[model samples]
Target: MALDGTGDERFYPGYDYTAPSGRSGGTLEVTETAACSASAPTDLAANATSPTQVDLTWTYDGTNNDYYTIYRGGTQIATNVTTGSYTDSTVAAGTAYSYTVRGHNNTGACDSADSNVANVTTPACTELTPSSISFNGVNTAAGDFSGASMVTPVDLMNLEFRVTEGTGGGAPFSQTDNFDANNFGNWIPSDTNTSNNWLLDANTTPSSNVGPSGDHTGGGYYAYTESSSGSYPETYWLTSNVLDGSTYALNLDFWWNMNTDTDLSCELHVDVSTDGGTNWTNSVWSRTNNPNSGDVWVNQNVDLSAYTSNNLEVRFRTISSSWRCDTALDDIVISGPARATEVERLAWNPDPQEASAILTNGNSYNLYARGTDPECGTVYYVGGTTTPGNSQAFTWSSCTETATLNAPTFSPTTTPITGPVTVTATGTATGIQVSWSEDGGATWSAWFANGATYTPTSCITGNVIFRAQGTGTCGTLTAQSAAAAFDTTDKDVATLTTTNPSPATGVVTIQTAVGVETAPATLTGVSVTIGGSSACNVTGAAMTWNGTTSRWEYSWDTSACGTSAAETTVTIDVTGTDPDCGTVVNAVQLTGVTIDNTCVDGTPSTITIAPGQTVGGTAVDLTTLFSTTGNVGSFTYKINGTTVTSPWDSSAYGTTGPQAVTFEVTGTDPDCGDIVGPVSNSITVNNALGTDAGVAGVASKNKQLDVTAP
Candidate 1:
């Protein structure tokens, strides 16, 4: 049948159409085209198979349609569905959807009405949960939270953990399975033949000389593949439950004993599956022969850090070529970097998240683990734990909270302090108080206000250490600063004096004394300076301690002061030190110091007399004639270069005519040792006439003759 553009039905040339026999005369009517249209699909049903997929099914009575079309929420999702069932993989997790189906003809020219509506909601994507959580580095003591209320976990590379409260110390994660319960625990054991499966035994395998003498855990159960009841070339597998590896680098450790025949081709394989054991494509470790001899068990470790999956699984496969091969496994342990729950991680923060509320004392806290998928961003809670609680809980106590206080500083940082000092503390805390400790911090003084003065009387000897403590509502905290040293031995003041204040040109003794003579003090050294010159300074060993006088005496050489005609004034300075007192100095001006050492030369260099005189007629006063600038003590006279007294006598010389006379005078000076002067006189001296006339008797006869001639 065909329809024209005018909506009128027409018969083809090769087909015949006839009306029923009851109405031959009336206009013929045909309803064949109206009844030949495709039938509508019925009983449509939609079901969500997974978070991202929805399976749809429907029933169809008529076969006039060539294909089916599916619509989700009034929108066409699939077309040309040849079968009654269709899968819509474009749905979203946790979303509600409405679906309907319709039948269509081969050319899509004729179509049926919409089928019954089907409603469905897709399940949410599974949340990732960690297999283990730890709080290894968290400080659980009171006041450790620093006023924080809520704790949150932090994501570390390949792991998660919480830092120490008020400090960021790292925490580690750990997990283990000893298999002492004689059961597989979370491990799934399977084999090609049921009779040849892996078994958990206490001591050894069924066959003698083919298995471990004992389990790795020492008198505990271990998993092993028994070859006694199975045929050759059989395979056995032991797989672990799903493990979450999204947050941590994981490692597997186990002890195994392979007592297999060296001639047989037996093998043991370790494999990993990322899709919950659907297919294991990664063969991490494999052993073709026995790793050790006898019944000794060898330890094996495998790293699972490369496979980061939420549904990670490990499997152990054993293939035995004969009954001589028996593989034993024990002490399986899984471990990774430390991990913690959100609350546990947050507890480790140094600062508080909220100041208004804090962790309650004596209250138990529950921990739960959760993770986000790096690939799809889906959150998965731990499979076996409740939403707010897990397998671990801890009780909090108020005793663990302590205030944070800093060390105190002293006003005088110099060692050997002798008096009281001020101590100042630095930090932030309520009701802060400070205390001090002496005796190397073994004992402490009473609490005082911040920056308080501390007087130490008992701990005056040796090294003294000072510490401070602060107390508040949270608790008490102590901090020790660098030590302050002190020495309490008594030291006396130094004094200086001189016995001869008005010293002449000679040695002057300067005395130095500390306090009283009997005082218990030691004079370490002494120095004295006079006339403000280095030449007159005396120090060190030059100043000798006089025990008899109970004083330190220094012989100051005044000769270095030089010669002076008049008195000289000078300043004298004395400095000394003692064991107790550091340094002592004294200064004084010394008056009436005379240093006269001047001598005068004679006024005349020489003296001469021209006329000759009789030897005994008169004595020449040569000492009176010669004069000098300095006082003359004595004079000596020489006539003709011969020694004589100052009053010369002519009788001493027989011949006396033009004789040479010299006079010498000596003088004394207070400073300069001595002075000398000389004077010369030329005079003629004749023998006295009566003493030497005529040369005795012969001269008398000649004189008689000469007298007669006169």
Candidate 2:
């Protein structure tokens, strides 16, 4: 209600509107601004302890940082570092490895480049096992080296690994015979006689006179010989890893036929030679009724207790035989105070049991090692426990003994993890999803996609593998994560992209938008994060409202990316958000207020002409009947349009009478267009003059279209 006193005088709406008094809006200024202290670390490190193990650890500046991410090579290994350290001990030995670390706040994360690498190689080992030893009339084959390639590496002067992978004895590259051949009498000389040795066919010719020395059949072959002097009958004699004070039993097996046996009876004798084979002592098994039949295979055992030193040898001879005691021995095996290398400890995953205890003194067990190895050891048990086999520990007075332990089985939820998988998720962009499997692809599953990070519930035990898969024409393309392993009771998180950012650039404020349960959600400490990290700018709200739209502006200059302001940004949909949104939030990248001129340029540009107005020579107005209209970039452009000009030009526009001159702001500033559209409206001066001459009273504001009236 206007004041009654104003009735006596002229009253204006704003006549009493002195200076706008009552305050409507004002900013609360704070001189001293408090900020969360620095919390996240810039670097992380992982160390290698064993051949196939890596221990990763990082630093946390306190509640200021959310979580951490670890990477191996270019691939991320784990996110959400609840504890300070992590151990990966399941990968195969002899592989190369590297790692990196990144920290996380609630909103997003800050990542670091990869760390130095940790290289490891498996240890050298020896464990020989041959299921069967066969030697007959024509050809003979011993050990698994039968079908092996003829050519060998130069370093392998004595041997090559029989097999890799399996517990027949042990490791994939386990050594069989110590081809490093250091044992005193390890290398036994063979007979040089190729023919007439009876062990050779009658058609075969002898290469040289029979003697004990160095000789061999190339191209994977075997030959035989006889002792003419009846000295050390065969080439190799038991070398002592023992002492001279020890007594022992000698065992031997030979192949011969009574028909081939010389008319002279070949006698079996036990010879003892100590002090380097110079002096000799011999014993005889002269019984005529002996298992003498050559056709049938016979095993002979003799006691050498009467020998003085452990350096004793055995021999066979027919002194006065006409056929020179023709003897043919295929294989001669000796078992005495011998130490066997076998499975010391066995188990896939032993429960709280000491590994040392599992490998006891001397208890042999059959080993059924499948999947390519030398030969299965004595059968212990097949297809049973993860760690099978009996305690076959080596009791060397010196060297270490170990039993084979089968690797624990893995149960992953995913297989060959794919990338860019289109999954129907709650809030995520269309991209690829990665998955993985452990234990020989036993189980397969996906990681929980949390913004820029993913975490698997349980840990991985043995083989851990991940694949990046994506949608393609054929199906899905999955790229494998670097091959690595772990042991039982191991847990892992995928840190494909995990890290925390702190001390933002523009009005920097780190915060968590979602639930802050995991200390290590994807990116952390961002103003508004899709995923939540433990550390946030949490003053009972999302970080800072830092955007070009807000009055309190922030600077996010893209001049210096990467190291300057690069952070993990996980994009998400916002049904409950504002339409004037910008790019996905970067952790705490923005620093101070940078020039962000988002203040809409609402300068009036829509100058208009009223109806029954004329400009130039064109008639344009409502009374003139101009029905058709068109849009143009700028009214000036429309007015000045010439050859090859749009139909909106004044020359082609207005349909009749007085043409009006005007401008519009259809595509101009949004706010200004709504208010000042068709501005500067006016009628033609000639038409106005004509109407004035015919009028009686002063022209009103509407009639005097060119006049500005209150």
Candidate 3:
């Protein structure tokens, strides 16, 4: 190639060098191509399809793009999308996000600007209705639903109920200590090493580079172990006050910080005790790794829901093997859900969202409702009710019937009756029916009408027991009366009358009438005795029954019972015996009874009289002048028809040479009547006193005259 003047020069291919200018010559050619362009997507929009998903859509203008790139809050979330719509399945529930879309062309190595920003919020978790529910037979009104709002369709609903036998249920149990007051509120500190126990530190630990620089509550006091105060391998423990977890699920939350030279040289352990801190066998949480260097405070939550005891205790234990490890603790809390004796998860249901439960009579209960959202993986409480004050409880009562039967009454109040017997009784009950039992309630008769009586046909020999039975819906009841006795022995003879045979002679008869006989008791025999003599006694067949007079008769021969002339008193004894009533006796006495026969039948045969006694002078005795041949009892004398003494006195017939005297004799006889004999005699009497001398002269003259007459 060669150049010549000041104007432009051109070089041709395959030419030699020019003489004036030395230059190389090459071929020069020009080629033309089309330009590639892509536009940004427009109208970018995002919609929440569910609690956890978001859908994005936009309009693309150029076809040169191979895919769309998605950005969320300035961060690329997806690429290589061939469609205008994209679904983000990684979004969180109840969260807001800003999205933008861009078009990209991998072949042209270019990208369009981002589309307009799309802001959207994912749907919140689902909630149930009725914040509280309560109902019984009497209170069936609807529940309160003012506290619940649903952001998503509920995937699952459950209604749960639990009966609490305990008396613990009300506000939740909460115990929090922020360590801001420079003292442990309810926390107690213990340690194996007395000098290196847990102590309250304000803002910083005593040793450098091993513990927190400040408390978790910002410059407040915190409990920490002092590593510099004691030997290596020291242990410290901080225990909380007793708590009640028997009725509710509980949680223990606290903030802690640990710094150590080695990763696992120091350790922190959370332990629970149900025996008042005597033992800590349950270690719920533990950490062996240390907080590298910053002494960062980490919040730790330990679930105490597995424990159910009134003496629950929580303690934090730190074991340090070297002085380079130190641990600090602050803002301790012990709390739980509302206190309930029990919590039950009911069966899963999606429709209606209602259920029923049966509660015990004396126990209390609590009702709770929960709903779940599958999209958001959330479970929340929507409704609840409690029975701490007996708001929802049940009591039981029973209904049944009962009847009582009283003892029966007999027609005859007295026992030992002879005729038919009647029984009556009263019962007390609702719709009661009565019956009778005669065999000590072993068997019963048919039901009787109200106020009815039961009577038997014939009397029984032994005692009879009566029972009254009553029946109703509840059951049958029976009552027994005192036993009624019947008489089997003979009846007593009340009265006895006799017809006396006074002045009884030969062939005498005795009659006796006994008292009227009562039924079931009859008289068996009758006996009679006369004059207290066994010879006159008659009994059994000797006495006969007289049907007309209803009397007993006996034949008594008076002649056989020794005769007596004088009237005599006699007693007739009548005895009657019944097979039922044993024996009875009746006696009648008869006075002036003359029983005579032929025993004394003769009279006196002779009588003699003595001559002379003067009147008004010495009396003469004539007691032995009469004689009888048969049993003479006495003699009677009379002179000239005048009754005289035994000896007849002739003094009353003063002038008479022949005075008349009469005598009579009576014979003693039992079989015959009295026998009488009469005799008469004459006696001569001289004139008395002036005749003493004349009697002497007359006696001399009678002798002389007897001599002269011879």
Q: Which candidate is the best by TM-score?
A: 3
User: Whose lDDT is greatest here?
Assistant: 1
lDDT of 3 by residue, 434-529 (tens): 455444334557766544555542423544545555553444444555546665444454456777676666778788766655521245556676
Decide which is better by lDDT, 2 or 3.
Answer: 3
Give the Cα-based TM-score of candidate 1 against the true structure: 0.29
Error of 2 at 115 (Å): 67
User: What C-alpha lDDT, on a 0 to 100 scale, does residue 643 get in candidate 3?
Assistant: 67
What are the models' TM-scores? 0.29, 0.24, 0.31
Decoy 2 TM-score against native: 0.24
Model 3 off-target regions past 4 Å?
A: 1-168, 247-249, 290-294, 337-366, 370-710
Q: Which stretches of candidate 2 lie over 4 Å from their true place?
A: 1-185, 190-271, 278-509, 513-612, 615-638, 642-710
Cα-based lDDT for every prediction: 0.57, 0.32, 0.56
The Cα RMSD in angstroms, rounded to one decimal, for candidate 3 relative to the true structure is 40.5
Cα lDDT tens digits for candidate 1, 1-710: 32333436565455855543443454545554444366676688888988777899877544688888887644466888888899987765676566767788865477677776676877877535323222322223344433212212222112221222221113333566667987888788999988778887887677876777778748898888888767778999999988877665678877776766343456788899989989996458876542223455656668887778989899999998778778888888876753333344343223433322455675655433444343223433333222222323444456644456666777776667667778777775555556654554445577788877876663246554444555544555455555566766544445555444454446766775555424423655566555543245443434677888877777666665545453455555555664444545453445444443233333322222222222333454445433444333444666666776655555544453424333333333322344333334344344535543211111111111000000
**Candidate 3 lDDT:** 0.56
